[model samples]
Target: MEDKANKAWTDLIQEYQIDNAIKQHGEFIIQAKDIKKYREPRLMAKWDSSESLPTILKKSDINILPVSRSAYVLSNFKLYQPFPENDINTVKYVPPLPLESIDFNNLSTESNAINAMLITGILDDFLGTNNTVETFNGRMGTNDFSFTVNLTNGGKRQVDVQSAQLEIDGGFENDDSIIIMEAKNVPHPDFHIRQLYFPYRLWCERVRKPIRLVFSQYIDSIYHLYEYEFAKEDDYSSIHLIQQRNYSFQSSAISWDDIQRIIDSNSPEIDDNYDDTSIPFIQADLFTRLISLIEQLDKVPNMTSAEIASSMEFDIRQASYYSSAGEYLGVIERPLRGHSQLSLTGIKLMRLKLRERRLELIKLIVRHNIFHDLLSQIIDTGEFPSREAIIDRMRRYNVCKDATTLYRRASSVSGWLRWIVTLPDTTEEFE
Candidate 1:
């Protein structure tokens, strides 16, 4: 899907001599009609992350920003900002309402997650307010405004907007402030600043009260909300994080005893014919991200690698790595020519509720002798094994032969073990 957009943008760039235009005038304005000559402007221009940028734009360090309903300005400006690592130690707020109506386990979209947050009073608790009503949401036209964005060339340029399109995933307001939210389900390292900035600037022009920009991400049954503020209202480069909180309705407290129970009662026998080379050794970490990918596949099955990359806002190689990790877990199936789909085991796992689903996944992961043995040692010694110890175990299991590969694979082993150990309700460090 992204490849098509890349090629179309490449052609459009050449046809319009965009490189020359920018060199001469500091920036170039391209109309939606001009972009539609090859591909839909919406598809070509909506890059929400640095990894999702078209090849041509990425190579030139150029980003596109909409200046009006029909036009976009292309320039070499820093447009994406990184999200700070979430504090895994944050408190999880259990909503006061009963969990009967909203099924936290089956939230499939950003809208569903946001609605769930609102219903459960998670939003209220995070915002430090009691009376937050859903005041505005969805797409709306922005009033004309001007802002300055720092260019990649160490200079600044003033950009004027004329009623550009702005979309707010959710907006809640009380007496003193309006919270403008942009929500996402898949976890990305960074996001395009425009998603929050446009709506914020528009509201600032129209509202007498303060406007707060909030970015929310739903991953692995947790709602991570970040509140940001622009230090200089007219400067797009001034976005900064003010506060962040993580919440989950379901219990995430998994102790060593819980893991021991699964290990003793449900550990699968090591097959004599099991081949270590049958699937790639698990190199992908971020167990939460792996769960996120599985949930995405469960909701939209048969997604191609490019589609997955685009939706997850990661490069195609990272997409392939996560998919391969999924395959190794027996949760994802990839065909030779078609898209990737969830396996039968994945379907069954997804059908379970939040706690049950996590436990089931843990069970699946520990099915291997390496994980099972490592976990048993952790239970016995109450200490995590060192990298050298893990590498030695991999040697015994014939997991891989190359020393460099062994080290890379050992990190994944350690990562999964950390994930399992930290599942209990306690403050732990996360990489």
Candidate 2:
């Protein structure tokens, strides 16, 4: 019965081409990867070398030292330590913290997965630990964060959506709180506008107060919380996307850090084509700082001075002192120059890049790999794995890596693959 129903819906969509709504713009995809490959001896050992997070978070309680900008924001709004309670349809905003030490040792895939499972009902375990979030199931009006519906008198009753989110009766919340938490499994990037708009419309049409949109995701070890406010008070549902005509991006929630990287990853060639009206509101210097914050390491797969220079695309003369620059940036510390043995920092950095940056780039590489595989199976079984085959696969995705001035430099990071946006699937379809 369900299959028949789904077929009918699918037939209707295809008949009317309803998929064109989102697809008319483009499909978003992340290359699929078999994550087990990353857990090899070379990489995991280093990331695990840090003191366990339990000790780190307690000592770093000085309320500073962010592992990333997103970390900084999440730390500031962490109502978790002493869970916040909802008062009167409002949430208290925690003030920003000062920096003391970056304590990333706390982040774990399981911890993140557990958080996501709660938010989206997608997974149950995180950081190898049982998710205790179910303890708060159905309990609301306790946290400074809550979602509530203000039902009016003498109106057709609307059914409240039941989900695993902290919610409360608006009348019970304090009037001073300003932020609304909208947690999702995979909301469209413009999800901010949607989450805020409907709620804002419902509330303003009934009651009156300020609203801030918060997007939380537990995909990686970090639970990203995004804050969004309308450009103007009258601007509910008034999101002006970076590109609307092309619908280049869905309304799914996008992290500030991810958005920043997208902007940074863009090449001058891409930038030249974009008008001032396109880019999001961002600071140049902050973006530069974010780029520089790339993890430093103790050892990197040991690139010799020549190989290191070659990676940097410098000539032999330039290559000779390459490790010096790497060392200067704390990227590598070698006992002697030519030997290119890694310092502890280099080894750690290499591991960090592999572990952290994998989702961003390697998954895309997998998509590229699959594209080649599919092409080989159908297009040319004989001249398989041809250069044209690879190029064609990549081209469909708009992966213009070869066209970049710093192609070698930029392509080194796997996150570079996120820029490729030509697939026939929404991020979900790919997943």
Candidate 3:
């Protein structure tokens, strides 16, 4: 049986087709279930007798015309009105604790993530405010309230928010206005607009002062804050980013020379008997990108693979790849099958000073016999070897046990080691 949402969607499709009153507005997707149905043997059998599959599909109730196996559009689909595009202009500012010289020991004691942001003084600079600040947390209203939200499918319906709990990570009421903030340890391409809208509405109803919605993120050891506002008062989806700024403290935690020294010290000792199929071989570089992901896990411990994927800007497969890389590095662990959580080593790294943290992470990788050997070869040869070289190197040790598995792990080996060759310059300006 179809669920309520799918059934309602079917009903909408039927009504529009029967009435010939389709509105070419709003965003909609042909549900995956229907797409799967179209792939059935019975459905494929009819393809030869009929016109092209997309032609037949257009006449059906699904209301989508397939452009390809992975692309499609509603029969009368029209693009949703897009918000204005603005350049993300940034002003560089210095952090109070040279971002590089952060004392992880002292920072670990701070229980509140918001306070930690404040102490860094980056928040003050980002907000353009040095006034004393006050924080708020917990529910904002005494009674539940019902509201309506515009759906992407060209519809609106009433939604009941119970207690409308307003969990503000960092908020401050200044003399002129109140700033409501949502903070994250890692950056994302976009966040659910409701993170700011719900509080904005609740507080606007309670107080006469204007509310400023701020989204703050800590990525690459820098604090980035984006100010957003709803262009339309009642439309939740109308949220727009108005301002963006980033700040970083001084950092010299790792250098090219440091990476070289570590790579040279750890020579590749082939462990032919080592079975490493449990972990994936790296497919992407950008070690700092992976570190930002680790920082995200540190912020929210024990997230399932799906949740981690949903929280990030990338696709689910990419999320799986990055998480797998973390697992191979031993910085992340999956205690339960299919569910990933930070390992003790990861937790310790999060608590150590920046320089110590960088060095320790290097030590962890170099200590691993497989990785140590790979890095040594990369540093010694001064170039990335061909895929065949990686496969040949792994074959000597019988790592991964089979050619297919060995090939996959080789991708990881080359992908991860590539980061050392192209580490980003930390001293350069950042936003």
What is each predicted model's overall lDDT from 0 to 1? Answer: 0.83, 0.29, 0.56
**Per-residue lDDT tens digits of candidate 2, residues 170-252?**
11113333334444322112231333433443444444545444444322222334445555444332333221010111122
Residue 84 deviation, candidate 1, in Å? 1.0
User: Which structure is stronger by TM-score: 2 or 3?
Assistant: 3
| Model 3, position 231: C-alpha lDDT score | 80
Question: TM-score for every candidate vs. truth?
Answer: 0.83, 0.26, 0.51
**lDDT score, residue 34, model 1?**
91
Which should have the higher lDDT, number 1 or number 3? 1
Give the best candidate by lDDT: 1
Best by TM-score: 1
Better of 1 and 3 by TM-score: 1
Ranking by TM-score: 1, 3, 2
Off by over 4 Å in 1: 93-101, 256-276, 282-285, 300-319, 367-422, 427-431
In model 2, the number of clashes is: 42
TM-score of 1: 0.83
* Model 1, backbone clash pairs (residues 3+ apart or across chains), number: 0
